[model samples]
Target: MQHQPDFSPAADRNKQPILDMLLRVLAPQGSALEIASGTGQHAAWFAAGLPGWAWQPTEVQPEALASILAWTRSQGLANVRPPMLLDVASPDSWPADAQFDLVYCANLIHIAPWPVCAALMRASARLLAARGKLITYGPYLESDIATSEGNIAFDASLKQRNPAWGLRALDEVAQEAASAGLRLAGRHALPANNLLLVWERAEH
Candidate 1:
């Protein structure tokens, strides 16, 4: 029997909303590099939504490559390139001399080690074009905003699974971005307490 690609119900639910935001923020044509293209569902959905944009989906796990490829093929997405293995913590894992107009990462930082946040910021800053934007989507804690009960539970559960893993504070994440020469440009509130943030070169 042929192997089937893994599916995320969350991915399916959020893909359209995410694409809607993408259409608003991005230009008509450009190159996009997805940092953690898990399951390739968002890659396929966004590629289809933004027909003129060239999308390259990447994963850190070798096992995930198959699922990404399967999803891309199933969708017949010509705009999406083959998914590549990219470990944000390892600079050696990134594609050298490559630049993209958009670096997209969603729901990744919280699950990974905290160091990964700084690594991601550094990598995104280096890979993005002069006018490029780095868009990250996930639940984040904010000093000014009260934490939702659901998010509190979710954060606790994440930390329970791995002490280093939990919802990150927006302020700290912004500081990391600043240290990497990137700045928070926009913040949009989406469903499920998630925030879609846009980061751009500080000097740009």
Candidate 2:
């Protein structure tokens, strides 16, 4: 049988790091909602490796959604659900019956507008169970630390492509999460100047 091509070279490079983070942070067994599941490569690999979690991968773009579904079907990953059409900016776009133990989003912040990031936090806060985790991976600007020159250039290029597309300040994101009843749990520095930010829903 011919295999569906994996569309994301970046996903191939970052999947292991993402898996390592998920292994440490996510609950042993529950549903994990993945936002912007580009190409579904990461979803398939993660669902296959972490059999305990039911992975629901979603995408906003139709083409990407089709690719995600193709990958999910090709892998025969029973734990991974069909790709959902989700726009992070629209709260109603989220599934009404879905409540996740963990919410994972990768490489979205720098590429999307700032309001999308805010919406993501709010949506995750609403969808996550109490004390459930939300994890995001991407480049960010830290208050005290200078970004690597490569990342700086990359940020500029992203903004040039779309004025709203640029790296977000870590402190700003934390504040948004806080406003949405989520608190930053930790930030892990990954290879390639990326970061994995872990947040948890605030306890009542």
Candidate 3:
């Protein structure tokens, strides 16, 4: 056997930093829904780090399911649940039985089409507990900040691959989040010129 375990180099590099930030931002014990769990790496690592939190790792692509299940089982992570088939573009497919305190997704905004972002934001609002939060990590373009050469190149490459895919504007994303009833909570800079955006739904 190849022993591949479905790897993503970017995930390996950013997982620790992301976890470090989550430790400070997220509450001690809560339920988490991880969108677009590509290889299950983050789910495995984060679940291990926050043992008190229950994690539900979901992916839309069927091809990614095996690896996610394999990784979760292999790690014997009690806090992580089995993988769920979730497509941000398909709200009907989203699980209705459960809501979460923390909804986390990484590298999704630019890779997926624009509609997916709207769908995700809207659903996240409906799926959150009263004080739940949505956290997204990815490279973005901010009008005020000078765009890094590497990020610009990456954005160009992404658009070349899929005309609809590229780095999103921070203000545009923030506006979309607002329309979905989420407010900008905070934003953190990560390594590799990426960003971690936090949106919160406070109790009324």
Candidate 4:
């Protein structure tokens, strides 16, 4: 059998931590829509663990989506649906009929431009039911402290790779979520200087 290389070593290392957070925040039974489901590793792991919930992994990049589907098929995980083509920046491009109890995105905000993050918040707000959750994981700058030197170096590298890409400020993200009618529920520090940000739709 030909070996297929897993594209994301970081995803492999962080899957367990991300899963732990999801298990705590996600509803007992409902659908979860994962945005930018790169490599499909997290989706496969989460779907297998939470068999009661449907996992829909989506990616905007064609190559990434193809990899996701291939990985899902290889794992033979029944709960994980085939990857959908989704662009966070395109609100209308989202599946209109699908409603999710949780909208999860990992390691995407900083890699994408600011407009994409804004669009993600708006789209997530629209997709989630009242009181539903939106979970995001990645590196961010907190208000009280200077960004860690490692994170600063990482940000510089990201910017060098793409001017639009870099670490985001937690406070700004929280404010944007609030503007979208979502309230910050909690922030959990994770390995490798990443953070798991949980937000819930605010009561009208």
lDDT of each: 0.94, 0.89, 0.91, 0.87
lDDT of 1 by residue, 1-204 (tens): 444888999999999999999999899999999988999899989999999999999998899999988888888889999999999999999889999999999999999999999999999999999999999999999999999999999999999999999999999999999999999999999999999999999997
lDDT of 3 by residue, 1-204 (tens): 423579899999999999999999998999999999999999999999999899999999988888888887788889999899999999898887688999999999899899888898999999999889999999999999999999999999999999999999989988888889898898999999999988997433
Q: Top lDDT: which candidate number?
A: 1
**Which 10 consecutive positions of candidate 3 have the poorest summed lDDT?**
1-10
lDDT of 4 by residue, 1-204 (tens): 533635789999999988888788776789899999988888888888788899999998877876787777777888888888999988777989778888999999999998887888989998897767899999999889778889999999999999999999988998899898888888999998899998888774
TM-score of 2: 0.95
Clashing residue pairs found in predicted model 2: none
Q: Which stretches of candidate 2 lie over 4 Å from their true place?
A: 1-6
Better of 1 and 4 by TM-score: 1
Q: Of models 2 and 3, which has the larger TM-score?
A: 3
Candidate 1 regions exceeding 4 Å error are none
Can you give the TM-score per candidate against the true fold? 0.98, 0.95, 0.96, 0.94
Clashing pairs in 1: none
The CA lDDT at 171 in model 3 is 92
Q: Which ten residues in a row have the lowest lDDT in candidate 1?
A: 1-10
List candidate 3 segments past 4 Å from native. 1-4, 202-204
